[model samples]
Structures are given as structure tokens and as C-alpha cells.
Target chain A: MITSGDHMNWKDNLIKIAPYVAGEQPDKRDFIKLNANENPYPPAPGVIKAIEDFRGADLKKYPDANARPLMKAIAEDLGVDADNVFVGNGSDDVLALSFRAFFNSDKPIVFPDITYSFYPVWCEMLGIPYRTLPVGEDFNINAGDYNCENGGVVIANPNAPTGIGRDLSFMREILDANPGSVVISDEAYVDFGGVSALPLLREYDNLIVIRTFSKSRSMAGMRIGFAVGGDTLISALRAAKDSYNSYPLDSVAIAAGCASVADRAYFESTLKKVMATRDRLTAELRAMGFEVPDSSTNFLFAHHKSRKAADIYDFLKSRDIYVRHFRKPERISDHLRITIGTDEETDRLTAALHEYLG
Target chain B: MITSGDHMNWKDNLIKIAPYVAGEQPDKRDFIKLNANENPYPPAPGVIKAIEDFRGADLKKYPDANARPLMKAIAEDLGVDADNVFVGNGSDDVLALSFRAFFNSDKPIVFPDITYSFYPVWCEMLGIPYRTLPVGEDFNINAGDYNCENGGVVIANPNAPTGIGRDLSFMREILDANPGSVVISDEAYVDFGGVSALPLLREYDNLIVIRTFSKSRSMAGMRIGFAVGGDTLISALRAAKDSYNSYPLDSVAIAAGCASVADRAYFESTLKKVMATRDRLTAELRAMGFEVPDSSTNFLFAHHKSRKAADIYDFLKSRDIYVRHFRKPERISDHLRITIGTDEETDRLTAALHEYLG
Candidate 1:
């Protein structure tokens, strides 16, 4: 008995929900492109070769719904059984599905207040009640804060924007406190520095670790991400994924992901290069009177003592250098998150900053 | 306070829901893949060229979130503005998003009982109530059946497994009767013969027409689908999509989609070839005493008077020829949905059938 007006009013839950705003992807290609934390190096040569060798006749058929080849590759690389893995379009898609499958409870879940912004958006969209636990003044997650009763817990290791990683023992504390609740350790940036909670999966049935190829593997445009956990947890995600979209990864992505995982030497060399650049860039910024954190990831979070964070961001942008600046959660309003790029790109960023400040 | 046992229990709704089962994609490479109704021809040469030309450096960066280039090409091809379009990973993803955005009302939506089996799966996953109206003895959707009060209406043009296309006037009648409901015309198979409801978008604000690159464009492995509608409906779908997953299509998919759409000559020639083969296949089946429907699609839905459908399906499979057979809804249980392959493939299928029945 609904009318036109009723149809126009989308689901009440969806109407008021605020969608997550991803980092801006400026149209101009000539810019330094450091805003979204993308890897400066191209993907491994094997990845490019895979796409080049793909046959047109293969595209005439649907991709394997299970993505068995990619799953097998990931399992072999991670030293886990195929049953322990689950893959999706990207970590965003994987996290969204996990929220639907595991986090729907009457009691609220708990997460760090200043973690990945997408966590709150997922809860809002799914109508799951949640409570945000504030991070310490140093912008580090306090494991004790998650000891209370809750439906589940999510933590992004090497937390974004802040770029600091917690020790594995700290993550174990959170998992031990909530033996029944599912504790998701998002290790998207784990390859850069942080000790992955992957080892904890052997002992904790409730631990689910999520990772992405956007950073270390240098395949962001291909859109591949995955989770590793106990067989039961992985099965629930599979059931949910099947009910939603059967073939989330296309054939091309599957091929590219397999090739990237197989070329271990290429991946190791690129990650080492990024880490070296990050250390050098951090020292240069601190010497320029910026309060740079002890970053464990490929990005540096810092603020100037005299210049406003927004001003520095604008100045950098004007010089064709992009960095992320957040306007809300007032505690971190003065901060700027600059992604670590190649040696040349990092040198250009430092030179630009020195000129602007002088 | 949720405890360990409480965490083990999933959402009440998801536990009882049965996920949709897609057409089988067997692991074997030698079989003639007619089960999923995929286009027999390879995608346009431009699609292959796009993949070949993609740079490894580009794969390191995140793809364009808005997919502007592909959107522009689709808009130009469809004679619509960019604001009127919304794209997704695949047509299945597009349909799932639409159900979440538009069909969460108190009243149950209506769809043909014998159409795409995925419709009910989407409803169950989203917790939306829906009723399936039975098709007529002729396997045609009676437009009058949709005159009742409901939240929405969904029709698959050149309906699956039946391959019957209703005229434009009948669709207009349904749209006229359901002025308050959102009428979704899924034109996944419309490129084969049916008149698209795209033209009606000018007159009806509540109409949404969905199209896919999987069918006529022969890019199923790329996973791209889109919808065209009034700006308001498109905005609602956008909100739902952004809330769920921001970037659904990968960069390679966007590039491949644009190339496929731009090659008009290749698209038309391939579609014409498919239609011609479909006609010949239908006549040959009828001559062999099979009850074949007047197909307006790339697939033929037929059944034999004396031979069992399951038997014929198995016989074909033994010879490496795969066709779809549905066992539910009781009405179409006897039918076999066979995708029209190339001329040589069609000859093989007919020859196989003759041997089995003889």
C-alpha cells in the first residue's frame, strides 16, 4: 500500500547513514600522488606478464566463482591451508562482509576511536550498535580498553594516519580478554613493519586477520584483498559472500594476484626500498621542526609547531604534492598524513616544504 | 553482555536463509560451456587490446573511484547523461544493490516465480519480503498480475530459461498501473531481441533499467554491469553503494568495458551472429520433436515429450556439452536452457542430441 513518496524514502536506516569519504583521487596525473598511501613502485613484473598473456577466449566464460587458483597461491604463500583463506574485491569489501556476517549482535562492539574511518560507516550501514574507545594521548590503542563485555572487537594494526603499530603481545591481551568475541586484526599495513597477529590464529579460534595487496604487493588498481582465520570463521564469510556476489574477483584480477604472490623476491625488494625511503623522509621532516611520530608503516604523521596543518596541506597541494588532512575528530586536526613515496618523490616533497617554510 | 556462545550465533536472518546457487562453472577446460548462457564469441578485439596496453605503473595506484571514463562511454552509448548512470562489479552486484536501496518496505515486492532464481536470494539476504507470482501456462508474465498493491515490481526482459519477450505496450501497462512502485526492468538479455525499457525513463521517474556487459558484449570475466534511471533513483543507488563498497570495478574492468562499448561494429556483428544461430538451433530442435519456445534471446528453452530433461542433460555432459537444467518451481522442471554457441558449436550440440535420442 506504499505510494510514490514512500518509495522515494529509501530504507530509513540507509537515509540517515553517512557514507565513508575515501581519500581524494585528483584527476591530474602529473601530481606527486602521495595522498592515498599507494605504492610508488609498479607491481611485480610477473603481474604485468600475467595480464599480457591472458587470452581473449578466457573472458568469454565466467571467472571461477571460488577463485581456486588464487586461493591456492595465497594459501601456499601464507603457509596456511586453503580452508583458512577468504578473498574479495578489496579489503573494504572483505571488511564489509565480515561486519554483516560476524558483528550483528544486540550488544555493541568496541574499536579505537581514531582507527580506520570505515569501521564506523560499516556499523552505521548494518545498523550494528558500537562504542568507540578513545586512543591514548600518544595516539596508541590501549589494549585494556577492549576488556569489557561486547559483541566483537576490530583493530587496525599500524593504525592509519597515525602510522603506529602495536606489539603482538598487546593484541594477544585483547584476544585473551574476549575469548568468545571475534577479534579482527586488520593487517593491511602489516607488511611495512608491524608484527602480524597471523601467528595468534594458531591458538585463538576467534582471531581473523585481514590483509590487502594495495600496498606491499603494489596491485591497488587490481582490487584484491583477503582474510586468514580458523575454518569456521572463514566458512561464515564464504556463506555471506555467496549470498551477495558470487564472483567478486574478475579473471584478470585472479591472474594478477597469483603472479604477485608467487614472485617473493620482487615483493621483498620493493618493500625494503619503501622502508628505507620512509626512514630518511621521517628524519628530514623532524629536523624541519615537525613533531613526527615513530612510524611503523609507509606513512609519516606529523604537525608543525608554528604553521597550521591545513596551511601546510594547502601549500603542498599547490606545489602539486598531495597529503591527507582530516578536518574532524578535533584532537588530530593539526596533523598531516604524508605517504612515503620514491626517493625522488620524497626529495621533491622535502624541497617543497623547505621553500614554503623559508 | 554478549558471551562466547552468544558470539557463535550469527544474525538470526542469515542462519535460515538459503544462498543463491549460480550456474555450475566446471573446472574442466574441454567442455562446451553453454550452462551459464555466456556469449559464444570472445569479447571485442579492443577489449583485448586495452588489457595489453595497461601499464604496470597504473596498477600500483588505486583505480578511479567514480569510473568516469567508463561511465562517459556508457552514457554516450545509451544516449543518456552521466547523472543517469550507475555502475557495479557485475549485473548480479547491481541487482543486489537495487534490492537493498529500494525494496525494504513493509509491503512485499512482486516478481515472476519462474524468472531469475537470484531475486529471492537477494530478498532473503536483505530481509526484504517478496512474493513470486506464477507465470501463465505459456510462460509469459501477465502484466495484470502486477496491479495489486506492492512495494515494487521486477521483470526480466526475454525472461531466463523461457526466453520470451513481451511487447513495449505490456510493459507500459505495468508501469502505468504501478505508479507508486519502483519497476525494475532487468535487460540482461534484452540486447538479443527485446525492446529496452530505457526509452521509458524519459516518461517514468520510478523506472530503473539494468544492463550488463556479460551477455551481448561477451565480457563476463571482466565483471561489469550498470543501470540507467532518473537522477533521483540513481542517487539512492549511489548512496547504498558508497555505504557498502566505494570502488567495485577494478581499473582493468573499466578499461575493458570502455573498449567493448566503443566498438559498435564488433558488438552488432557478434549479436547478429548469435541471433542467427539461435533461430537455426530452435528450428532444428523443433524438427526433432522438442517443444522449443519462440526464443528472443541467445538461449533456447525447450523440453522433449518423451525423453526426460535430466537424462538429456547428463547425456550431453558425458559428451562434454553442458546445458542448464532447473529442478525447482515444478513448472519449468522439464525444460533445458541451452546457450546458443557458434555455428560449429551449434552443429556439435545438435549432433550430440541426435546421438543421445537415437
Candidate 2:
């Protein structure tokens, strides 16, 4: 028989580590959820049709370990060869594998200090040494800062929480300087008007651009994310993934993913709608005395000069409007990262903000 | 510009590792697949209903990262508290997380020499040192052999490729001996007439019994597996999982898993049918001069007295019947591990075997 005392001895690394905390997924669905930067619209009509038409017998057998058909579809959609594509359960899964595949060394990997919170958590969990380079005052990535001695580089394009995107030339500069290390551009929000580093794959073998269906394709519930890179980089990622979990994507995900990739028209129309709503929201937030950054992604990073960000967040919550507000880095404590929702949701959010400010 | 030749360097550990090869999911579905140990019957009717009724709007937002609802359902079904359950994309995912969470130390972890092949692959990928203890001459786990100094222990109940299950008392003996370490009873095949170590969880906080929806519930393609353990162990696994991928189980999987668990009668009926077919197949193979073990899984482990296992495998493949035959572990090189499929699949396999033997 074991006792409570036996629980004290988990691995030393795990014991000292703090896990990543995702944005709140409140139980109540009545809120206008502007948190998590998720797509406000439904997935493509084809995705729904594919799910409805899925065969029950297929669930009796194991899914294709490689998910070749979905990978092929993703590759064609991204204008890459199937060999250059590697998929995972989600972009987080892909990123974790990539970190294992590429970022273990004597030197530390480098990323922006205020980038996606999960990067540092991954580094801590894997025991990979990493140094955080701070983003500029404007919350834009300074590529010059990352061209140093390091194991690798990971930059979220259209950087999360900030919604700022660096130009392709800046990405090229980093790639050229870091010829020996893998530089991953997490393009989770690139579909929302940000320029992708995918074209950089042809120029730099070290460049791996990660994308996801969660944000743009409106399939966050499905968990599909993939990486596009040179064959060698992709091969390494595949090796790491296969070693961990062979069939990461289930049949439903694969079918939904394929349908999502094939329906280019719906993807574009939805993205355009989000971008339009984002512009409108940015204007409204600015009109209300909030300094809204020019967002390339679907979210606006805004700070009210008079009101506390936390107070605004709490006030919005009271009115059932959910937006993200991070506590760390201290500098952005006064900022609220609001995801652009449907026109109605945006209107509701602005009205709530006006009432709170009044 | 990057060239194809730039593919020379990956991490040293990854470069040295060889990925696990899953059973071939042949594109052609005409052949009888008895290779990967998948369930023969379709998923529960409720599972199908869940899939058909999945809303597109739900897919727009991220799934509940912790999968609390499904965990609650699983816990209720398993007669455990929700805190005792830790769910993942599959049992493979659960095993991977458990390995990372518990098995990292100077001392080497241990497992059976001929258990699931992924165990060694995970060790190689994660740099976890593991020593393999050979099973008994009869291909059964000898608990006494495991009562030694080690970092951790992972035993697949009803050990894979050789469908023999160790009794709960024997598991208790191993647990009582290894009080300082976590003993993961991978009960992947335990539902097939094998007694689970779950009842021992009240006495042993160190015992973690893993279960899956793939085989018994006929939801392999949906990829849901979970671990039941003390709160401390479950907390550690959850921490590791959250650190890695916040949302491993997609919405479709959660819904289907809940539906499958709720349909108790369907699960029991399907398992009974497989067990019945397995008994009949074992008798037929024994009549054909094969040594068949008393299988406690949805598969049979048999060896022909005179024929080469590789030759038999090839012969069956030619006849559109697929069965697993591993080349390593020379003691079992002559053995064939065949999954208990539908009655018609069993008949076809026997007919092909008779033709080959005649």
C-alpha cells in the first residue's frame, strides 16, 4: 500500500517547473468571447459536411499514422511538396516536437521576452536553455537582436498579445544570419493579414513556418497544426513526432482538415470578414481613448490612458464580454488583447466599454 | 538561396534515434486487417450520433483544454474520482506523458523485453535510460524479477504480442516492492477478460492503470486514452500534458468518448463477441498444429510447429490477410500475433492458413 508521502518524489525538473496557463475557456457560452484569438465564424461548410459523412467503421481501425492525405492537402494549399509538410495534433504539438528535434544544445535558444507564453514553458519542460530577447517599445520583433550565438530562434509572426508583424525582409535578415540554427516562425495568426515566412522556406533550410487551422479555418475544436520546412527539417520533426505519438491526428481531424484546405473560397471570405471587423473594432477602441496598435492579426492590443487594464477587463467580464489580459512582463499590464469577433459582438463589446468608461 | 544539400545537421540525439514503425494502414481496404489489434465492430450508436450532431460553431472556438466533462464521464464509468483521471489523445500519448513525468533519473527504468515496441522508442527520443527484463519462458511477466532498484516500471497488462495477463495479486507484489517508484500498469488490453489493477488504486498511490477507447469501445480512429491514479500522480501527468499540448483531445473525441463510455451494453456486447471469436480461432489454430496461448486480449499469439513465422506472414499477405510477425526477440520470431477480427475475417484467415499448410 502506498501513502501520501510517496507523492513527494516526482522528477526534479518537473517538480520545479511551472506549466503554461491558457486563456480562460469559461463554462458560460453567453459571453462575447474575444479571448484566445479564436475565429468568431464557423468552419467551412465543407468541413461540416465531411464530419457528417464520416464513416463509423473507420473509427474501428487506427488512423493513418502519417496522415498522408491531409499532409498532401496542406502541402498543395501552401504550395509546397508533401515531403516538406509535417502535421501534428495542433501547432503546439508541432512546436513541442520542433523544440525537441532542433533546440537541444549547449547554447540557449532565443525568443522575444513577451512572445507566446508557451515558448518558455516548453523550454523549461524540455530542460532546453533559452534566453528571452525583449521586443521593442512598439512590440515589434527586432530581427537584429536575434542574430546572435544560440541553438535556435522561435518568433510568433504577427506576434501574439501584441498583434504586430515584422516584414519579410526582417525575417530574411534573421535567416541569413542564423544559417546554422533552425529559425521557426509560428504563423498561427498569419492568415489574418500578416505576411507568412513560408516563401522563406525556399531560401533558408533553417526556416520552418508553423500554421494552424484553429485560428483561420475556425477548427480550434479539431486540433490540426502543421509545419512547412525543408525536407531535412521536416524529416527530423517527423522523427520526433513518430517517436512520441504515431497517429496524432484522428480520422475526423484529417477529414475536416482536408475539407478545410480544399474550400479556399470559404477560408478567404471568412478571413476577410475577420480583418474587416478588426479594423472597425480598432477604430472604435481608439475613439474611446484607447491606444490601439495597428494589428496585423485578428486581435487588437489596446491600453486606456486613464483606466486600468485589469479594471477594464473586470468591467468587461461583468458585462459578459471576455478578452485576454496577461499579468506578466509588467509593461503590458495596462493593455487588453481583444480578439475581433462578429460585427454584433464587436458592437456589444464597444457598448459595454462605453458604459464602463462613463 | 537554400539547397537540398543543406540537410546535414539535426540534433545529435534525434539523428541517432530510429522512429517507431506502426503497422501498415494499407490504402486498399479490401484486405482483412488483423495486424494492428483494432476492434472489429463499429463504435457505439451514441458515438455516431455525437459525431453527426457536432456543431460547426463549437469547432470555431478552442476545445476545453483539460477535457473535464469527458474525464468526469470516464471517472464515473471507472468508479474513480475525476481528480484520479488523466486523459490524452491516445494511450500512447498518456504513456509518453507518464514517461516524461515520472521516469527521468540516473537509475534506469525497466520493462519487459518483448512488450510494446514504442516504449523503447520513447526512451530513445526522450533520453530516458531503460533496461529490458526478459519475460518468463512462457511469455508471462514474472513480478519477482521486477522487485529491484529502478527509476520506474511500465508493464502492459495482458502484455502485447503475447496475449498473457498477470493477475492483480502479482501486480500488487510488484507495487509493494517498488514503493519508491511509479509502476504504470498499461491496461491497454485489460478489458478483454483481464482483471484490472484499478481496485488496488485505493491502497497504492503509486499504481497508475492506463485504459483506452480504441479496442473495447471501437474508437481507435478517435484516439482517446486515459490514466487513473492518485491525485499526486495524476496532477504530475496533467502538468506535463498541459506543458506540452494544452488541448490534446479535440471536441469530436471528447463527445465520442463520453458517448462510448455511457453506452455500457454496447461495450459489453462487442467485447464478448471479440472474446468468443478469439476462443474459436484459438481452437481452430490448435487443431491445425499450432501452439496457441490462452489469449486475454482481442488477439491470438500462435506459432506453427514447423512453418516459419515470416513465411506464414508473407503467405497470409498474399492471400489478402494481414497479421503481425515481429523479426526481433528471436524466441518469438516464429510466432504470429493476429487480432481477433469479425467472424468472416476469422474464417478467411483460417481458410488461407489451411491452404498454405495443405
Per-residue error (Å), model 1, residue A122: 1.2
Query: What DockQ class does candidate 2 belong to?
Result: medium
Residues A287-320, candidate 2, lDDT per residue (tens digit)?
9999987999989999998999999999999999
- Chain B in candidate 2 has what TM-score? 0.95
Candidate 1 per-residue lDDT over residues B126-241, each given as its tens digit: 78899999999989999989988887889999798799998889889999878777889999999999889888899988899998999899999989999999986887788788
lDDT of each: 0.87, 0.87
DockQ of each: 0.53, 0.55
Model 1 deviation from the true structure expressed as Cα RMSD, one decimal place: 2.1
Model 2, which residues run further than 4 Å from truth? A1-15, A19-22, B1-15, B19-22
DockQ value of candidate 2 = 0.55
